[model samples]
Target chain A: MQGAITIEGVDKRYISRGRETVALDSVSLNIQPGELVSFVGPSGCGKSTLMNMIAGIVPMTNGRIIHNGKKVSGINRDVGYMTQADSVLPWRTVEKNVALPLEYRGVRTQERKQRVDEMLKLVELEGFNKSFPRELSGGMRKRVALAQMLAYSPNTLLLDEPFGALDAQLKMVMQQQLLNIWREQKKTIVLVTHDLSEAIAVSNRVVVLSGRPGRIKHIENIDIPHPRDVFKVRFLPEFERAYDSLWEQLSSEITKGESL
Target chain B: MQVDESAAVGTGLNTGGSSKAVLAYEAGLEQRKMMVRVSQVLFAIVFLSFWQWASGRIIDPFFVSSPLAVGGRLYEWTLNGQLWSHLSVTMLATAFGFFIGAGIGFALGLLFGKFAFLAEVMDPFITALYSIPKLALAPLFIIWFGIGIESKIAVSASIVFFVVFLNTFAGVRDVSQIYIHSTQIMGASNWAVLRTVVIPSATAWVITGLKVSVPYALVGTVIGEFMSSNRGIGYIIAQATGLFDTNSVFAGIVILMVVGAIINGLLKKTEGWLLRWKE
Candidate 1:
């Protein structure tokens, strides 16, 4: 069976101003196909760095990432990444922004048009095809961004704290929306989030990472059912147990980062 | 600002799909447009009336010619077709110079912006040329290219080229990293990313530069005319000044201002049409 993602002996290092900074050290993890995984820890745990490697955006200093039994070299069309900022093209309307990937891949006129239309509907932005990004609210822009990423129908999604900037209401709404979209598509998702609660709310498994030169501190398999409720997540005894356990592990990582 | 209201209404009507509502909306828009025009007319009358009165009684007509005298001079020139010929020459020179200069400037900006080494090599030469009074070299342009439209076009184009080049260079260079990352994640090739991501991002800057350069082209033409041209509004102004015809000078300046306004208005409209994506 082809695992969705297999990271073997991965080490990520960045050399800046002649000082070598090891972002990740021999971090190894395996993501099963269709697994919704969250990389969670204190800030500077290199969650984003590891996600970047999985998506082939950042080259690992050592080791390799294999997606579908193929060693990834550069950007693979099957992977879709949504970073912290919703960098929707200012020039394109909502529909056009969603259709960007298809356009670049030379998806034919009729099919691309239909996919754009369908994606807009999927993201509940059916009527916002012509609205520019500036005209959109932050939450609405984020939705457009989600629509754009989902438009390409990528088999895997790497999201870097996409809901980090939103108001609480919008964030919860987006978390649910992402879950619903994930339910519909069942793509392998690697989400990097600092909010431990958000990680627990969405992911099938939460990987707690250590401080700088991040390594997996703890891996807890979430037994939560699909169509999970963010509001009810905190009340679940299992949720509290997992969160408390992860916090205990993460506390020292954050403290170590500050001390350094 | 009112233009924005109608646009919102237009958007509202588009999704509503009610024919009667759209028809009523269109009629309402027309009414607003008529009211706008009427207000403009009233404002123009109030201002011009004050001007005419001031020139006739409050101020010396010698210092500031009465609107009537200028109108009469404009009428005489129009009847004799002197205004038409002179205006055409200036218009021709301005149009040709504007296109050539804008074209060259835009191309160079894109090239230099894309290639940093090229930009570095050309920076000193461009800066040196930019600082020199473009008009001061008009006589030399005339000597090199002669008294034809070629000289005028060259002079105007040289003036316009630098401004547009600088703006376009900035526009292209400032392509957002976020957008680039987004495109890269989408697996966009270098050329595809440049065309879709880079070019659109920089269009607002390029368009702004072009709009400013439009009037610069006219200045170039008029400057060239001051030095050597036998036609154009600049040529007419030179003749009028030789004979101390201040009225004609005012008339030429007035006409030039009007043309400049019309060109700017057109450019703004084109920007509205094309760069509607710009915030």
Candidate 2:
């Protein structure tokens, strides 16, 4: 109930050198608290723009977003945003990276350490506390980034292609871990990804957007039961049906995007 | 099961053979190192011998002093405590100028880096000051600081400031935007971002600037001493030139060389410690 998000007539435009480009059209959506929703679309569909708008990093040309009962203005610090790039600070050890947000919040040293250790364990990176980001493998570093975002226990999460760079096997493992965490934490999660199957596997509802000036084209409610295994969920008939419908909707947008 | 056991045995033997190959490679490396050392010693001995032989025979001893004579002069200076006094004076000037210049440069670099408008406004002025040959200011420095160690320090500091400031400024500007953005999203204040992200990120550049300016600091100090100072290795060299004592001049040059090498070694150690994460 605390992490519910409301978007109404949200529009985003970028103006450079007196030329204006529309990134997102008038879009509206309501995300209930503790719901897992995925935004799947072609490249340049402004999926990331929608994510940034919710996080309040990018200002909307018109319209507004509401997180919980509060209006989204400036940086929405109540939500943790994990960017697509490797966002872990290379200089800091894994433990230090996870503790960064806590430090910013002025958490006491004792509690910060305890929380960092707990978060690292949650991400299954218990023994890598002292290791630098450079020393960890790509997937391990991603875990550190995940732990860092979850360190402060923000009620909402905006993950922008968090596992896009990972190999297929590693990506599935991370998805499984994310699902487990989401189930346990019961936080509102908005995932923007290009992977169609990943959307059906992790999200309770899949929102497909049209290309360039992104607008919500279709929303499918995944009928799969809770605690679905990411590996096995794809084989389910319901999962396949959702994927087929979403892919059909998404592929047309990709072709339109290329032509434009 | 039999196939698996044989494959394991094969891997074990391969590991042993590879380790032996590694040992042989290490031995080869040691031998090469020894060869380099021997060759270096031989080159030094031969070069010194030729210089000593040529000083009186091929060229006048007045112009090119014999190595033995230079060595004797160094010994005499050391015995009379003149070497230590002059060496200390030069070292003090270099250290003072270096620290002052590096400190001011680092501070200004951070300040300008944080305030882009200030950096842009001051760009032309900084460039003008930097372009003026620092050594050419030695006479003015001597007049202002009055031929004391202060003048030498001023000369050294002025030269070192520019080198460090430019590097630090570039380092600050080159900081990754993603890092800053992520830190901000984590609720870091501007000061917190600078302290935790900007400063640490720019450390490699700062260290490089410091390392590069060490020689420049020494150059400024020696040039300052050459212009006006009554003491220092540069003074010894200037006085020897006036008296036509090429031996003392050569001795002074050798002392500066050794000092430079020692300072470089110390700087390398500091750089290693400061940037251990890089390794």
Candidate 3:
């Protein structure tokens, strides 16, 4: 029950220079505890906006989001949020960066060290504790970020294209790592991504959103069982069918968005 | 060929050629460094000799004092304790002004950087104030603080304030939004976020500002002394010029050059230690 989230009629609007723009309109969704859901849509879709709302970083213009039966007002600390950009503090070494959330929670030094070590091992970056972010390669930095996010063991994770910047080979490796973590931890995850195959490969359900003033267009149940090989999952018949159906829904929305 | 073979063997693998290449590259770098040092020493010798040779023949020695006369004057001052008294006074003024100015500027920068409304409201006024040539205010500072060390401190502090203030402001304002959001999501309080993310991130800019402002602080001090002072190096120069003692004037200028170089070296050391993470 700790990871369950209910978003009711969430709307986001931005008024700038006296021009009102609707970013998301009456978008509603329910994510059960331990559910892995992927949100996919065109470029302008409110996919990231919805994720931000769930994390309570961005305030909704109207409606509400409930996590664990409590209304999320601001900065929901129960969830970990990983943005597209690498958010590892450049000034901190890998160990210190991973220790940040634990430090914020007032965890003692010894426990923080233990947790940080565990996270580094989880992300396969066990030997990189003393290295600064600038010293690490792109994929390694991402691993550091992942380690940092997992350090505090948040019940839920809101990832907005966390692997978007990675090359294809690294992306698959990361996806495999993510799936393995998901299986072990069973934390509720809401991933916002543009990659259709990524959406279908890892999630229990893939939510397709329409462009601009986004609304849910179609929800596809990915019946492909887990312990999924992210590299080979696409070869499954069910995976193919789901990808084709979701692409059909998503492409039309993208074309309509471009015309506008 | 023998050295290369030995180096390759020492490296213990297929990287033998690369190890030899590295050794050659390092030797070349060392050779270059030695060449640069030798050239620098030769250049200084030639330039000083030319200046000494040409002082009486090409230009009047009175107008362009010879290096020997300046050195003699410095030796006399050092023996008589005049150098220590004047140098100490100037150093004290510079130190006090640098600390006070940098402290206030850093504080105000954090204040304005955190509050966008306050910064926006004060932007035009701050810009207008900053536009005024700071040296032009030395006379005003002298009048307010009198012709003592206080005025010199005031002048130097005023000059340093703007530089530190602007750099600190930009540093704080430019902290990455993602960093702030990441900490916030981790349940960091506003105070925690500022301490952890804002301050540490802005340290590079703040240190750069401090480094840049050191010379400005000294300039302000000397200018203040020039406008009105009885004791610092600037006063020595002013007094020597009034007496038409070109040797003493050049001596004071040489002392200042040495002082500036020493201070700059110290600052570089501090900067290296403070920003070691940049490597």
Candidate 4:
């Protein structure tokens, strides 16, 4: 009854300054409905490259990405893609920023205006609708970004380090907000991050990636309940075991990526 | 990254966020407070008083008119409506030149920005001519268009074109790659991407160019008028110089200065309205 994302043996490469570098190699995954999956590795791990493929920001080198049953070509409007930076335009008001997609899709003005109201209320940005991005705190801007992404009610949410810019405390708060939104909306969410603890905190399943031409080393399902408090659950034996297992499998690949 | 702002209602100050980013706010306030009203008034008073004292006691009136005499002549010319008609002529030439030049500059800038090949190929020629003194070509312009509005308009447009074109090109080229990637992921068509991302992002550059070109338009028109025209404030100054009518010369100079200030004010007002987001 719900949508799923299927990656079929995808490969990606980038040619920069006359050097051809393979980014992803024969990566395949099946993310089911209501799934919160995270990809974790060091820099240039191709976590971002894989996310770009699913989001269709970059063309696949040698594979197919299917959202639901149809093949994705360029960008998929039915999916929300959030990047590491630049999720908002500074010129747009906070409310206008949130309602950008709806505006672009040519939603009726009246209906869209009402949705803007609903969105601002949902993001707790009701009174700050007129405020610009520069006026808002870093945390507030991220919430606005999340609200904007949620406005279209996409079936899939692709996050590329949504909390990368925030401080540690702020990142925790954002993770909780994201968890709450997922609980209510039940969108199939895929997050890419370098932080191992963050990957385990909010995701239903954590996919560990080997650096450089990234491939999944391990996929560990948390089997934990929703709204899991990281502060309380993070210290448990199960969490420690899962973290070690991922580190053990990824340690060599991380070194390999760094040396190259 | 949701702020717990529900607890911060009516706080009146973002003390927490302000404390977190003091340098950004402090530098912003410093820029805003840079416009010194008192210094401006004092400088104006000192300059006029010095003009009056120097002309009345020591300096030759033929070279530098007294402030009082200049004021009186300005008052007389204004009452007879000579200044208004001349001001109107200058204004029309400036406005026409600015619009046409700015319009073309903006379009060409966008083209050059989007097409790197065109920019690379044409940039050398643009740079070579941009470095050349445009005023030297005034005689050619005068001979071609005659001593009329067209010559002034052509001069004004020529000077402003380089200023605006370069700015628009830089602005477009300066747009964040993040925005482009985000828009592409949003499924925006090429036209939509250009309209939403390219133009708005480059507007800051275009506005910067506009500020620089406002005075450029005036200088081009005034230079053209000085070279060949029989009307405008430039004509008044040129005529007054021959007769040693220092008061009239001073009056014309004062009129040009004030007119320049007023036009700058108008340009700033327009920029503020369009770029309220910066605030």
Task: Estimate candidate 4's alpha-carbon lDDT, on a 0 to 1 scale.
Answer: 0.84
**Tens-digit lDDT track of model 1 for B1-279:** 223332443442244556887799999999999999999999989987888899858888776776677788899999999999999989999999999999999888988988999998988998898899888878989999998788999988988888899999999899887788679889799898888988788889999999999999999998888888788899888998898777788788889999999999999999898798765
> Can you give the lDDT of residue B11 in candidate 2?
24
True contacts kept of 2: 0.42
Model 4's CAPRI class? acceptable
Better of 1 and 3 by TM-score: 3
| DockQ score of the complex predicted as candidate 3 | 0.38
Query: Which is the leading candidate under TM-score?
Result: 3
Candidate 2 per-residue C-alpha lDDT over B174-269 given as tens digits, one digit per residue, 9 for 90 to 100 = 999888878888888999899889988899999899999999999999988887789999999999889988899999999999999999999999
The runs of at least 3 residues in candidate 3 whose Cα sits more than 4 Å from the true structure, single-residue gaps closed, are: B1-18, B272-279
Q: Report the poorest 10 consecutive residues by lDDT, candidate 4 chain B.
A: B6-15
Candidate 4 Cα outliers beyond 4 Å, as residue runs: A227-231, A235-237, A258-260, B1-42
Model 1 ranges off by over 4 Å: A1-3, A225-233, B1-65
Scored by Cα lDDT, where does model 2 land? 0.90
lDDT score, residue B82, model 2?
Answer: 100
**Stretches of candidate 2 above 4 Å error?**
B1-27
Relative to the real complex, the DockQ score for model 2 comes to 0.39
Over A1-260, each residue of candidate 1 has an lDDT whose tens digit, in order, gives: 34399989999888899999988889888898889999887787788878777767778899998998889877655688888877898888877888899988889989998998888777666667788877766667777888889888788888999999987776887898898888888888899988888999998999999888788888988887877888788789989888888889888888898898
Model 4's DockQ score: 0.39
| Model 2 chain B worst lDDT window (10 residues) | B4-13
